[model samples]
Target chain A: MDRGGRMTAVVPTRATAPASGVRAAARIVAAPDGRGGTALPVLDGAGPLALRRTRAVAPGTAQVTVVGAMSAPLGGDHLSLDTRVRTGARLAVGSAAATVSLPGRCGRSATYDVRLTVDSDAELCWLPEPLIAAAGSDLAMTTRVDLAEGARLVLREELVLGRAGERPGRLVSRLTVRLDGRALLDQGLALGPGAPGWSGPAVLDRYRAVGQLLVVEPRFRDRPCQVAVLPSDPAEGEAMLTPLAGPAALVTALAEDALMVRRLLDAGRQAAAAAAG
Target chain B: MTITTTAPANRAALLVLADGRFPAGGHAHSGGAEAAVAAGRLYDATSLEAFCRGRLDTAGLVAAALAAAAAAGVDPLLLDEAADARTPSPALRATARKLGRQMMRAARACWPSPVLDALAAARPRGAHQPVVLGVTASAAGLGPLDAAHAAAYEAVSGPATAAVRLLSLDPFDATAVLARLAPDLDRVAQQAVDSARLALDSDVDALPAASAPLLEIAAERHAAWPVRLFAS
Candidate 1:
């Protein structure tokens, strides 16, 4: 397939040569139709990526799979993804899960970038599981999303600082969100800065882990809804961290300080749950 | 009402950030109230304050970062990108944009400055709450520390108010959370003031990479639910 064409495919097969890594490319071409829909293209390291129907699984279905791999293994290697969902079409993309190996002296890391384009009336949900970076490994990733007029897109990416057990020292991550040529969200984080206030009331308050989820659906526009957990009209589609129940209650009881709520967990789960609840 | 020429802009900035009525999409998020309720963690003001403080600390870092970035005259967009990087969960990012859009609306309504227009031009995008607050502070003639204070306060308030419902917190108890947080809020404001002087390296030392892991797990689990109340 032509590299410059709107719809193209590139896949490296084992027979082609004896390489350790695999490379694949797929594209979507939407005509002038007023309606939008997504074309699922099942990708393989050997053959051309083909379109398939969106798949669904049963409840309590928690399974993990690794779709592709590198042709050869080296001291440091990575995986990459480049995608663009056509306008008016809806797409939900996710990976089975990620398996990460620690980096040696080379200190090499794996990376992934996903570029999404949503046109008018189209919707996309890219909620992938957290990719754990083993100890001593450095990882960097970026997700660039472009939404056209009246388009809706939701892209979710989670990064585990280190495997729950492997326990990586530090994980650096970045994310950028844009719509209609305007940048809506840009965030960068480095979890291991051992400073004076590092784990104090002034900073993260010692939360060892971190995670966030972003959802952008135009359908919810002008609609007033509350999170299931916290059924309050969030003045804005936003909420931050509050103290944990244990610490907050204890502090207030002991110190007579109402702000005691400012002493507990970071904004990740506690805040989201409390606020959403 | 008495008026002071000393710094009328500071009061305005505070008002802009303080008013929960700002058009920013923040109204859409219950902070983690939804997640906490789902997790059975936040059931009352006792739990609500704890939840609010955690969010304040984690998100405060980002707000402080934005305040510092704005004080340094760095591009608000860059600060926004930095904020984005810090937030790993997609649900939170959506919440930010929703709030941002509202801030843009409020800014356009209350303060018709060029920066507000530029941000409005950016629309449903670009106009994140912190970025807009910083720029609006600049436009309204407030200092970085003051702007940071407003941003931090708003960050705290959004969740605190939501907790009232989740935990069935009494209005008096909820307001007490704010009053109690006074000293720390002042201290955080000072830190935000100091952070404004830091150089804009990708490191963003002003903030930390700490977030609630369980919250993320809940958000993911919440999104898949067929019927849910919160946007996060």
Candidate 2:
């Protein structure tokens, strides 16, 4: 963990789980090695988490994958992920599979906390799999991102309330995004059972899945991005796109199921990437 | 650093601010009720009540907390950022600032204050509606609880009023809907005040972050409506 070219020790900050449960933590830090290559001097994980860095897809860019046990139930599990992209570096992180959360034996809620930071002139694309909250399960997740001036980011989050024909469990998602010490976005939602009329027309209107794509770049603020409503395409669902005050744009879509949401999100990602470029 | 007194001088200011006909430009917006009505989701008194109740607990609670924090003397710029963070829809965010600018004009004419003037100067385009509301409440010598109550009441009252026009619901029923939710409004206002008090010692993130995704989505759709009675 080098701060301003100074070597700082990378400390393993692990969450203390109960004796009957499991806790996982992963940290990835990427920076420029000064030889036209990306350096990942800090990559570590603990518990039911694993991390791997692939070959650079582009100059000074690194691709990483976060893998968890396929058979192990994600009940009562606490997963913490920390990512940092230093100056002049780019990192793209994604998960290997969708997380199907289940009710823990101890009845404790599963949690995921992600903290991401991008330095000046850096970029990060976070494309995680959809989180499917199973019946009778409880899950809470939060994502906090800090970006420096001139940094760029494209982050996507997809959520599915439940499996087919099953009553969805509880899922609460919270996000806080800041640029240059100023908060740009702060949003929280509680979905599934006990949530207030989530399927109401003024809300989700019976949509079972939702996706959000956020793109932030210095150039986007100057462009006159149109905020239009597309016809409700049966396969694509409903989509709305809008540009924010600064270098940020947001796209929110709702669909009949996870596959449709993913389709919409994929299209949104392509559009946002092109706009950011 | 006591800029204003904790004790309110004008208890009736709450009533004045909470009035729907204060000429703050609130009449043009249905608070997403137009979208719901067009979608055939709110056609009767019962469904309108359900919609109002849902909004009061989520977006209403968040707005009340922001208002309470502003009345508690938090920085208006910070609260404006907090409001932006809480609002996910760009259309809604623009609507808030528009309403805020309109409210500032009225507040300046109604209650002249150096603080309000400073805020107006700082945010010439506008701040957020809840931020302006809290600041106006403070300028009017109202307390944090008063600001919270006003915010909470507006959350449901605007939609209820809009429903009357959109669905052609009876005025009596709309007013009755507000009356029935009075107890819930009080509870939400109290919770807002408590959250604001906590925010005083901690980060602004301590404020409530409750949100209604459908309302946010509907607002975006409503903003693009070619023929709509309400603005959002």
Candidate 3:
């Protein structure tokens, strides 16, 4: 039901999307090999969203990285990425560099939809690079992850308000994940345009870099992690880990720079790993 | 003979629910002000106003929308799930449900309704505070607008009062800060009502997802403090 509904919703948006910018659809599917290694049966990319296989971190894992083929995902563009890790397989997906959004001639906001499925006993690590919303750019991004029972995942998303020295463009992002058809987390954040007080003391607080890390494991249901602060430079930013209602925990951080933001999130990832271990 | 007629709306009932002494257990939580105070981000009324404004636009707006949706006679169960999705911080979620249970007890005492009873039976522990607030408004013969206003008011009022205690500042200054935020509160309530109405036709995702990441992070850290005045 959800899959059908999502596809229907994407159709209308894609149909009316500005014709002046690139519209891309991509997919990656990984399955387990009989020899206990992971194999990518399907790796397809279209338009500006290109995919390349990288060396595996472990013998049983397959790694893929997204390489931007062009300066795409501009205003009025519609982009979609679908990835599935089959049962018993492990896959890690990342990007080569930060995605920079620029204003296009279409004058409409760009849209990016990421859909991921992790089957039972499968593991997926989604660590994409930061998406920079430069001035005059308007983009809306949605990330949805569906996990079967016993699935494991580590997902991270980071946003950079603007480039080196300028006010940011409008960026609206939503992250929703479900485990066994139940909601684990659904958070929406709006920054840049149309979001008042985005940089206020209570929200971003003069910080430009913000991101969240979500980690999940089957054992968390029996032994949930504690809510605590992850150590980081006070001058850089702060980080915290809060267990979700399910077998997962979320780490949220805000920092003065993208590098610092990554550091805070990295600390969270390690803490989550150590706690789960 | 003196006449007693059922008015168009129980407008005065809204005041009772919105009262600070409503026995909802909200007074125990500082709404992140205690954390902000510890971090030295809020000192005088000036910084307090800024923090309240930011929170109102984000968390406050989201809560108002949830309350309005519940008051509009939507399924409380669905709205409860929606609330869970919007609240990413476990500390905040637990705090909301704890307060909801407290409010539920008071609502049952004040206004007896089968709907309230049904919701209580469904959520034996509790629902989200805003969802319960909306149902309580409905049981009291109020409308979605009233519920939205009440929630939006609570979002900042709790923190403002907490600051007075945490900072030992003048009570008058805190009240003044709320008075200045009256306009922002109105805007947030209106926005929430609009989103609630939209959610009636669409899914709950139509509601705003605005969040204060700093507020959430601070609340999580505050829960670990050795000794704190506020529960959240």
Q: What are the per-residue Cα lDDT tens digits for candidate 2 across B125-173?
A: 9999999999999898898889999999999999999988887889999
Residue A116, candidate 3: C-alpha displacement in angstroms? 1.5
Which candidate order results from sorting by DockQ in descending order? 3, 2, 1
Backbone-clash count (model 2): 2
Lowest-scoring 10 consecutive residues by lDDT in candidate 2 chain A?
A1-10
| Residues A1-277, model 3: lDDT tens digits | 1111111111112333356877789999999987998999999987768999999887799999898776657887889999999999999998877777777776888999999999999999999888878788899999989999999999999888877676888898999888887767888778887786677678887788789999989999998888878887667888888788888988898887677788888888888888898
- Which one wins by DockQ: 1 or 2? 2
Estimate every model's Cα lDDT from 0 to 1. 0.49, 0.80, 0.85
In terms of lDDT, which candidate is stronger, 1 or 2? 2
Winner on lDDT between 1 and 3 is 3
- lDDT tens string, model 1, A1-277? 1111121121212343323322334343322233222344433232222323335342211112223333211113334455455554455655443333334344444344445676776666565544444566555555666666576554444444444444554455555555565544454444443222223222233343333445554433443123323222222112223221011100000001111111221222333334333
lDDT per residue for candidate 2 within A1-277, as digits (tens), equals 1111211222112234353667678899999888876788898966666888866566667888777543223557788889999998889987767666667667778788999999999999898777777788788889999999899998988877776677787888888888998887777777887776466555566777887888888888677355645346734477666676667877777887777777666666566656666
The DockQ scores of all candidates, in the order shown, are 0.07, 0.53, 0.61
User: Could you give candidate 3's per-residue lDDT for residues B1-232 as a string of tens digits?
Assistant: 1111123358889899999999889999999999998988889998888899889988899899889888887788888888887787888888999999999999999999999999999998999999999999889988887888999999999999999999998999999999999998988888888888888887777778788898988888888789999998
Q: Per-residue lDDT for A67 in model 1? A: 39
* Index of the highest-TM-score prediction: 2
Query: For the second chain of model 1, what is the TM-score against the true structure's chain B?
Result: 0.83
| Candidate ranking (TM-score, best to worst) | 2, 3, 1
Residue B112, candidate 3: Cα error in Å is 1.3
- The per-prediction tally of clashing pairs is 99, 2, 0
